[model samples]
Target: MRIRHPGALWRGAQAAALAAAVCIGGFGTSGEARAEYADVVINNYSDAAGMRPVIFPHWFHRIRFRCKVCHADLGFQFKAGGNEINMVKIIDGQFCGACHNGDIAWSVENCNLCHSGKPGTPTQVHESTIQKLAIQPQAGGQQ
Candidate 1:
């Protein structure tokens, strides 16, 4: 057999690693893109005191409900910080409680589902989500 160039081997290895990352899903998925999910992030935003309220990752809700379910019925306000949602109201069947009374999205036992605000932390399942999206096919056929 002929000897192979070291540079070529490295390049091939790099490409394989990238493909594996994309495939094995430490990066993102290919299905979630078109899956029609909602992000809790600032499709809407408001200033408070000084800092931003919090970014809501819509993808978080995608696995749970449809857009109308929360935006129209639950009164999620469509935009971040737009709806009058909070822990107290959620517990009382006002905002999140519109369904979360153990019948939908999850139960009150999973309070941080909305309050955690961030993704992929101990509280929120956002990081795993990022990987899920990475592997998912892009929405509308665009990369």
Candidate 2:
């Protein structure tokens, strides 16, 4: 019999949890893996400010970033409206500010970046594309 390191076990568990969250909650099962959502609206505080709901284009982000980058590393929840992001936390470099710090991507000061109530104008990625990208690797091909 062989003993496994505790740290290795912990990492394995975390990876499993992340995989479950992605497949079950976020992306759904293989058969049901279609378009979960085209965009996410951030209205946690928009109404209070009398502003339009911020439309987050899922397709736009998915194209450039891996799901793990935002979902696991940045701590964004799997479901829409799951992450309670606010302006204060953002300015403090918490949620959106994590990358939109005027360095990694764009400055949060660029209000139009997120505040656009309309769908993003960037290239749209279909659900099939996403599903293929996420599942192909597990099926023995590149992700």
Candidate 3:
């Protein structure tokens, strides 16, 4: 039997687990692989500031980094719409700025990169059934 390095084995296991997660997460209820759009819409102040809401592509980040990187290390709240993310906080290297400060990722100066959501959209988690359920019916019994 050949001796395998412990670090190499750990890294291989990590890579395999990541691959499995990606493969499983990419499928839908119909068992077919589906594409995911921008996951979160951050419109806390974009509309008031005369800019489009930010479309945060969570899948893009999730595939590259583990959940703890943002949730635990960066102190991001796990629940949607829970974190009070703002430009002032970001520019101060608090949240997204930690990585998007022109080194690890694109700088905040590239407005269109993140602020590419549609006009008049509120901050929310996209593709959620909760949003569909929250829609009230019309006065005439129309959905």
Candidate 4:
């Protein structure tokens, strides 16, 4: 069922595809990248040393805690590594201990979850690997 003005149809499809891509990337233009976790290093740090990487996922906690939960109640230091915390502080009510203490994510029993803060850590690592290994069709079998 070939139609005339094929170019117009192609353009329409291209426009639709682009719109879809933008929607996915922007997540409805919330003005932030919607990922499981975002590696954000707070700055104005000297030599990036003060700039410790922070992992934030809007979806994960948004379902449970409000913005004020971490931003205010937790008093998350906005500056890079500004508020260095340890287990002692957490057990007494500070940083992640504010909620992650089993009441929220999983308490002291799950200490290693957030504190370790491993850069290579992945909440779920399968999807990206599969995409990278995807097979692509070649121009010619004997090329």
Give the per-residue Cα lDDT of candidate 4 at 42.
Answer: 21
- Output the TM-score of candidate 4: 0.41
Per-candidate TM-scores read 0.39, 0.55, 0.67, 0.41
Per-residue lDDT of candidate 1, residues 1-143 (tens digit): 23389887888887777777767655444333332333333212222322233345566656677888866776665443466555577688887677668776476675344443322211112334444534332322443
Q: Rank the candidates by lDDT, best first.
A: 3, 2, 1, 4
State how far residue 103 of model 3 sits from its true place (Å). 0.9
Which of candidates 2 and 4 reaches a greater lDDT? 2
Residue 132, model 4, lDDT:
24
Candidate no. 1 TM-score: 0.39
lDDT of 4 by residue, 1-143 (tens): 35469897898887666676656553232222233443332222222333223344446677787878787877885543466655577788788678767776677665334433333222221223222233322312322
lDDT of 4 at 19: 71
- Computed on alpha carbons, the lDDT of every model, listed in order, comes to 0.50, 0.63, 0.72, 0.48
Model 2 misses residue 124 by how many Å?
18
RMSD in Å for model 4: 13.5
- Between prediction 2 and prediction 3, the one with superior TM-score is 3
**Could you tell which candidate, 1 or 3, scores higher by TM-score?**
3
Question: Tens-digit lDDT track for model 3 on 1-143?
Answer: 23389887787877676566557654234212122554887777787899988888888998999989998999988666578888888899988988999999999999999999777666766655443324322312322
lDDT, model 4 = 0.48
Writing each residue's lDDT as its tens digit, candidate 2 over 24-71 gives: 668544443243456665566665576655767777888989889888
Task: Identify the runs in model 2 with alpha carbons over 4 angstroms from their true place.
Answer: 1-37, 118-143
lDDT of 1 at 102: 79
The candidate maximizing lDDT is: 3
